[model samples]
Target: MPSLTAACATPGMRRLRILPACLHEYRGFSALRPWRRPDAVLGWGRKPTALKARRFAARHAIPYVALEDGFLRSWGLGVDGHQPHSLVVDHRGIYYDATRPSDLERLIHAAPFAAEELARARRCMALIREYRLSKYNHAPARALPAGDRPRVLVVDQTAGDASIEFGLAAAATFEAMLQAALAEHPEADILVKVHPDVVAGKKRGHLLEAARHHPRCRLVGEALAPWSLLDAVDSVHVVTSQLGFEALLAGRRVVCHGMPFYAGWGLTDDRLTCPRRGRPRRLEEVFAAAYLRYCRYANPYTGEPSTLEATIDLIADQKRRHAQLAGDWVGIGFSSWKRRFVGDFLGARARLQHVARPDDAPPTAGIRRLVWSSHHQALEALERQPPAAPLWRMEDGFIRSVGLGVDLVRPLSLIIDASGIHYDPRRASDLERLLNDTTFSPHLLDRARRLRQRIVSAGLNKYNVGTPAAGLDLPEQHRILLVVGQVESDASVRCAAPEIATNAELLRRVRAAHPEAYILYKPHPDVVSGARLGQLDTEARRLYNRLITDISITALLERVDDVHTMSSLAGFEALLRGRRVTAWGTPFYAGWGLTRDHGRHCPRRARRLTLDELVAGCLILYPTYLDPRSRRLINVETAVGLLEQQRRTTRALPLPQRLYRGYRHLFIERH
Candidate 1:
């Protein structure tokens, strides 16, 4: 019987050779024989490949056409429009989807004849020969300086996927290990070589900047190959970089701090464990298992054979495809699934509903009101758009502020004082003077004189509804509104400031709203007791009795129906506990169409929502936290704990300068 290979023989059709223009430009086509003809040329994005292909075709007097998924789809012969597919063209300029037999038949029928197709096939073969992979065996032999100390070399490709941001912590750990190793082997010379591709300026500077602080660390930003560096060093240290395996090939010791694909392979000493474990194997064995056994890394993004040498080419191809089909990419399975499964899909849907229908929404009758007093321009911009809930402004006056809470004024509405107050920097001086004064400590004061005059002048005497403790006995189901202010004369209602006097009227309002609600007005933690910039001339407790309610907010919130505030996190906390949040001012969470807005019209007013959605939006989506060293997103739990601790300790929690530097490097400088 004839050999089995003879059964597969067919005439006329031949394998096509596709060569990128860069191949001819760099490596000449001297190897191509006349018998092998070029069919159609292939290249990357629209600009370079198309231009080069056209030039080659013009020079050779052959027909050339651009290869693209969109061009194929225009002929109504492509798959899914966004699916990764390839094209083949004959000598007569007939094109077909090589992946499909029907497309090939169509091309054959549409073309002149089999002779022309064969000629195109021969041309492709000629191009393929020109682009054949060549062996590179010019690496130098391993060498190290004669010494008892170990020589360490750190290697990594600075370009592509190697990022210092994600690997900074591991890099720091490796640096520490390297230092310890250097101390143990005092004569050891540490050499850090940058990746040649990276040194060529394809990416930002390598991890050298992060490691520069160490005296022993050095950056080699030249065209030195990683393999050459590996030959010189006795050992290697890495985070999850590919150089670890390359160093293994060079018969060097490797210490890994992160779970690179090579980790747990019994060869290198990995400091971290792989979260997803498989059958244990050696380092080489893992590489074989990944590349040769289990994983077949075809270009899933472009549906092409993704050889290691052509990986970058395939990536460029896919990137071009992504750019071309940018809008359609969103509707694809992967992106759609991410938005649905990993994100707040339900909340997004609900928000969409709220946005679509605003007329049927119910009124937020019982929320607090807050006003922006100083930044009139900012306030005007915010007020132009109706807030999701009701918010009262300072222009509405104190009577309207109290009316939101008063039972006789408005039964179901919660009252929040939106009057803007001034934040005075000079108050710090008066506070220091009052604290040091012998007779007038914060605990003692003459309320009949100065305190009474200030309250009477401020028109707060009428809103005096007695202490929160005293008001609890009144036979009315009411909610108290606490107005917390920032600085004394700043005039803007900020929650994070250090003054309590500006918030005095808010505490008074809360006392009037909920006689039973224990209205506790705690001063800002930043403010030291007995420190007064101005004299109230009354003991804090006595003034509490004479001018306003003596209800602690902690106790009041416990029994109250809801909280009212202007952009305060207290409203967030209240919302977290299932208490109705009447935002009398605009907070980050206000316009999300979740909370009750007192400032503008309520669009999606009556829709009851889960607390989780509100929490997810505010806590997860709105704020940005930076890792102090890398300036990436900080751990949320860690940030919350830090904020809580700072609140308790009353110490400054300034962001680390390194984090700011990292931010500048990553965002501002890159842009």
Candidate 2:
């Protein structure tokens, strides 16, 4: 976008584009570039480095805006290092400095609380409580000490902080806050909560050590979530720390020793008052003022404008996955190439150690063992785990990648099944329970429908490699049945279709069943590329009316009237395309009402399902899709959108990857 460089020449500065350069020395600006030329200069509060910007603006006679981190700032601490997710652009003044009324204070005083805005604020507050989230989410939540005594939290802050300098606080203020907490809650246990920066050794705080230790005094030194502690406390004390504001949200009695932005608005028990902040405000009102109105949020994952609720969801999702992966993990029997991509899905916090045998996994309380789902025997053996050690089976999802996994292309989506693997019919998988027991909400069904529409509209398939071909000419007035092929020795075929497990057998059976129908045989891409097993001999190859090797599976699905398969993913894709599907063996999509199941009955999968329900379980809920670029877990729609764009640009592999794949196909497969 062109910068408003010529805006200064106009009579009024209506279109001024403010540009910030090297705003903070600690965390250099990761802001989106708009620096063609600045119509105005931007400076981060009273930081020493911002003097250059202020001087430049004064010399150039350009207007300036003050910037600070929004209340919903980041998943990491600023003092440690962070690129904030939200920023408050304050033209009036920064929110921290109490000498002047910042834009946030104005919003708090005057902004109308429309029903929609209040409703959104309520929902956001509920989410924060449910997720136990904060500005920084890396901290672990530990159980508070057991006692009958009431708990009082004394929140600490980094010394020489700007908030202290401007929020009418000093060194004596901290000591006074501690003395007040001791005197007010004499019987309560005093949890002196230190600053996160203090815990991290990044900076020193006001209350560095015990001035005079009491029997009730306990220094909270670990990097822990404030709400986790807040929930267990009866009252909170702070000298301009944000936790005092959060204590108000937690419904605790707050004693503010300094005039923090949240203080003197009839919210906190303020020792010093801001005469300008005299109006009474509800917690939701304050939240609405700070988060929804004053702050401008951008999604860290996708780098786009986002709402508070969406950012909360994003952070909560990451936190939940991180907590799961926060423990020691042992990946059993993953190939060397596959190992490189596993951590993207497992989590950045997980300490992953790949091993050859299941026994190599430490049988510790916080350890988890994961095996590739195709290794059924090993997963079966590992399932008899002792207490506290979790086991999961991993497999590629339907919308896998733009190129074949057999060709060493990294997959976008994979299923992390805590129950049995999806393809296995001997027992129930998480997908089976999802299909059997889940009450598919209208919202989810609609999402599934739209996702299916997007997939069909984009003409996307599992390995989106082939281009859409022109419709194949066939005998008129005859039903067309597509017989899908799979790797003969694959686990799905071995478990579900022992009788009709091979491509030749599947083709012969289909041809005999639909003798008059025009039959087209579509072999698995792995077999076509000579990467894995399965292909037909000369006599067996003649069992079909036509063979489709070049056209994309999506194009073939659109052209075919019906589909026949012995446990192939293409069968499910065909169902998504709204075709009549006959499963010779039990695929995950089979045994539900969707497909005609001719295989061994799965007593567990007895529920009838709509097409959308099948999609909700298999595509939406069961799989975890990771964005290769962002390394962030994305929803199916995002994965599909990425796949569509990639398919358009990448119908064929690049030279280096192609050469590498060729070498693997020839040398590795041949061996």
Say which candidate scores most in lDDT. 2
Write down the RMSD of candidate 2 (Cα, Å): 5.7
RMSD of each: 29.6, 5.7
lDDT by residue (tens digit), candidate 1, 199-288: 556664345553455566666665433555665678887765656766665578988765554555467876655333433444333333
Per-residue lDDT tens digits of candidate 2, residues 1-671? 33333212221112111112112222222221234335655566766655666666666676656776677776555554344667787767788889887888999997569989988888788777777777777787777868798989888887788888788888888888888888988888889988656867888887757522666788887778788899889889888888877778778999888888889877788889888988888888889988888877765444446678656755665566566557677888888888988877976567788887777777776677889988766676777666457787888988899888877789998888777789988987888988899998665687688878888888888898665767568776899888998988788999889889788888888887888998888888887877776879898888888888878888888888999999998999998889999999988888888888888888998799999998888887777778787576666765776776677677566687768767867887667
Q: Mind sharing the TM-score for model 2?
A: 0.82
Question: Model 1: how far is 530 from its true place, Å?
Answer: 7.9
Off by over 4 Å in 1: 1-518, 523-561, 591-597, 602-609, 627-633, 641-671
| lDDT score of residue 322 within candidate 2 | 60
Ten residues in sequence with the least summed lDDT for candidate 1: 4-13
Candidate 2 overall Cα lDDT vs. reference?
A: 0.77
